[model samples]
Target: MWSVPVLPFKQLISSALFCALSGLAQAGSDLRADDSRLKSLETTDAGRDWEAVGRLDRLGEGFCTGALIAPDLVLTAAHCLYDRDTLEQIDATSIEFLAGWRNGRASAYRSVKRAVLHPSYVYDGTLSATRVRNDIALLQLQRPIRNTTVTPFETDVRPRKGARVGVVSYAQDRSEAPSLQEVCTVMARQDGVLVMSCDVDFGSSGAPVFSFEGERPRIVSVVSAKARVEGNPVSLGASLADELALLEAQLTGTHVGSQLPHGVSRVQVGEPRRRDMGAKFISN
Candidate 1:
């Protein structure tokens, strides 16, 4: 996570509720809003399913959903590649990507060939994600995935006001489950960002938000942040297409870092810890 965490948007809502509902028990449970759902591999491609996206380090071991973005690129949250407390980079060698994981099957397990976090991700402490700022990462697999079940590489076109979109990811809190569901709508686009009614919780960070641009699904943004008032997930456009073109020319986007406050890193954190408790964020 940057000076900010990729996930403080919902934390604010949780915090607000933690303070206000400390006394009401179940009566106060719904005081705050929540993320709708993240899409899942199984739901999108029934022929194939996610095994598990695993990474290990001196810090510990964890998992997340890994979706194919390109022949060699996998998209996930930037925080998954860095340390939350230290703001230090994680050893890529210690990282592993597991796909098609389920019922004791490797489905797909590959080492991270390379990882590229969003350059503009802000580390500042501000967490207004109605239109998210920081929440994206790209990982290249050692070997290209070749299977029909695998989702194809795609990114969103400029969103329309009521375009249909949803999320899919392996969320936390469900130790032995990966339920991918569709329940989000593109609410608006402000400042070149896409807003959605999609709900997100821990483990939902970096999940791809899809919109039907034409015949195929186009990814518009990634799950970046959330809100207490709107009860929807804020997604930021993934600048990979334009960013990669820029990086090739020796450049990066200035939106995130340029707008961030001091004392923050360029990386943004979005995925949640294994222990967090919420309505299994972003179905899928």
Candidate 2:
């Protein structure tokens, strides 16, 4: 029951025309920012409990949202470990995780020693549901963080379509501190990718999607991109249950050493992805 906001006549006309041309199906309206629920953690009470969700700093160049899954393991989008302009893999040593970051301080900080992506993940300049499904990466920390305040999250199964979910992300405008969308919905599940009705932006890539099922929260997906499908602003994510297991198995073997199968050096020329659909495929 969300209505489009009143806009100037020209803007409204242009919007209508754009929707028509895009062939977007008119479904539910996009999510609205209440500020009360999705407000900045820097000035909110919810910030006190979200210590495990941290910022993945890529050598001061940029950042992406990440969360700790183990004492020495951090989870994020595979694309975040590469440079967008050059498409080159950023050295794992150059990345750091700032847990519970707020006002230029962090409860725990650990540098990355290695990173592993899904073996099937290849950046072939194509954007598809399968690509997003395998867009996960695991960062091995140089040192383990054994703090009570920064407990790692547990992984869980993917939620069904129309299920209620939540997201914690550090976006472009709110990069200083993370924000929590306590209420978002899974719009659809195409192939292995999830299209969610959550609000995300540039730095929101790799943000953790959570499900409040039991006593503790469990991670279900990793944010990959934001898009406008049939006029509805939706966020894309990859289910983590299978992806995490594969990455863990890769890390357990020597595949992560000299014979890294998911190394970022792999790329190929192919159909360029569509960027005009509000898809911000950013490293952040």
Candidate 3:
């Protein structure tokens, strides 16, 4: 029951197409000169009705995207897991995370309790541009989100070279319905990782990646990749607090920010996501 379509981001844009390919993959001059504190993107409509904690499944039938960051996690990509060498498990008992989701209804459907896939995913099928190098994944909810736009996971600001990113998914089809556009910018940043101009297609893959701590919008990056810069397609990514400092050193303490690594159990988030986040929210 998540409905909120207003449309009009250049009519869902398909013209900017990654800013008409003004460039591509170029950052390594030794790298590491981009620090932070440049700010200048303040978004309105309360961060655009801000509420995207992702999930919706289907793929072979339809849909695929994700968000949510701790308070029950939810940060998708690792090829959305599942096809793990055919271990298959997509519709894990009705998964959902539609915070502010459109055309589908869920303004807050929170369920999902699994979906890991990032120990170096190998789906033996084809989505492996080199395991997409830990294309990132996580969706652990059983319930813990206090909400306020469910935004966590910052990876502590890194990606630079223009900085001023944006992107809040629910893409569906570039127009005619399903609102939410999110003005973008960043443009480039390789090593620290970034290539924005925010605007994606087809469910807008694991979309997240906002920038505005001065205004209070978190999430550092996601949206795996969707090339065509020269031919006109966009979206490609990495940099969620700079890969959460290597996933907080392999999720030590589980918060990727610290506090879980004691007995290492406490994972259980909800009970539907299907990759396993159930059993261990504090059981050891």
Candidate 4:
């Protein structure tokens, strides 16, 4: 019973299709990201079990695609910590996460030290569907990678309409490394947004979206933005069951910024879009 679709980031990117040429394997049948289903963890046994999937850099503003549900959190995409056009909110030690990056070396970098966003994520630029079902975010890592090859990710349940989901991004012509389409699907489940087909771009905003049923690979949504819908090219998420337990109790409470209880507003929906706007909003 979830079919809410407000949709309008200037009419869904004024006629969508922009994730550096997103086709998402043509949405429903060949879950494609070609090259054998989008694999490219940049070798070394293909990123050795995805070393907690990372790359969230922000220092100069430009990057997204995170994952690592613990050992210093991480999870991403609350508009990638804002600042689209002075909506501002960027200072968490300038953010950074790297972890297993590849070729540009990273296996663990850490920096940001505290962050949270899911109190009904009110970024009000009107890209409704409650802003991609409250595009999530979490950070918090100045240290604590406890490496063993980075393992950390676990948050299932939220895959339904056509299930079979998977994605691991870091896009914009494959920035450095991180790509694992692994057969996408989940083609619709509105109101908590999740119209995926996987394969995202623009640094694949907070990428994660996994859901491999039993034995590992859990996550359940994160990407957030890259819609086209009726014309295909989906991808837009935000459904960690109940906003990841209220963002893990506001990331272990103590009333975060503005005294918590739902207080962290940011708005920057379709800023100067049309640079091939396919409903892109992965922030930064």
Across 248-283, the per-residue lDDT of candidate 1 in tens digits comes to 222123443254335322332222212212211221
Best candidate, TM-score: 2
* Whole-structure CA lDDT of model 1: 0.47
TM-score, each model? 0.63, 0.78, 0.28, 0.32
Q: Which ten residues in a row have the lowest lDDT in candidate 1?
A: 275-284
lDDT of 2 by residue, 1-284 (tens): 11111111213223433343133224434323321257678953668778999998876678888998888888899888777667677798898899988778888999999999998886544455556778999998998898988888887777776678889988777778899888888766545566677878878889999888858878888898775555556677885755676687677674422443564221111121222333223221
**lDDT, model 2, position 130:** 58
Ranking by TM-score: 2, 1, 4, 3
Residues 70-144, model 4: lDDT tens digits: 788878778878765576777867878998798789888989888889876765544555666778877878887
Off by over 4 Å in 4: 1-36, 44-96, 102-108, 121-132, 138-177, 182-192, 199-236, 239-284
Q: How many clashes show up per model?
A: 28, 2, 19, 2
For model 4, the run of ten residues with the poorest summed lDDT: 266-275
TM-score of 4: 0.32
Give lDDT tens digits, candidate 3, residues 140-237: 66776776654554433544556665666655452112334444556554433355556566556666766665465666667765654334444556
Candidate 2, poorest ten consecutive residues by summed lDDT: 1-10
Task: Please list the residue runs of candidate 1 whose C-alpha ends up more than 4 Å from where it truly belongs after superposition.
Answer: 1-6, 10-60, 128-131, 175-177, 230-241, 247-284
The residue-level lDDT of candidate 1 at 18 comes to 31
Q: Which portions of model 3 show Cα errors greater than 4 Å?
A: 1-23, 27-73, 87-140, 145-161, 164-185, 188-208, 220-235, 238-284
Residue 264's C-alpha lDDT in candidate 1?
21
User: Between 1 and 3, whose lDDT is larger?
Assistant: 3
Question: What lDDT would each prediction earn against the true structure?
Answer: 0.47, 0.71, 0.48, 0.68
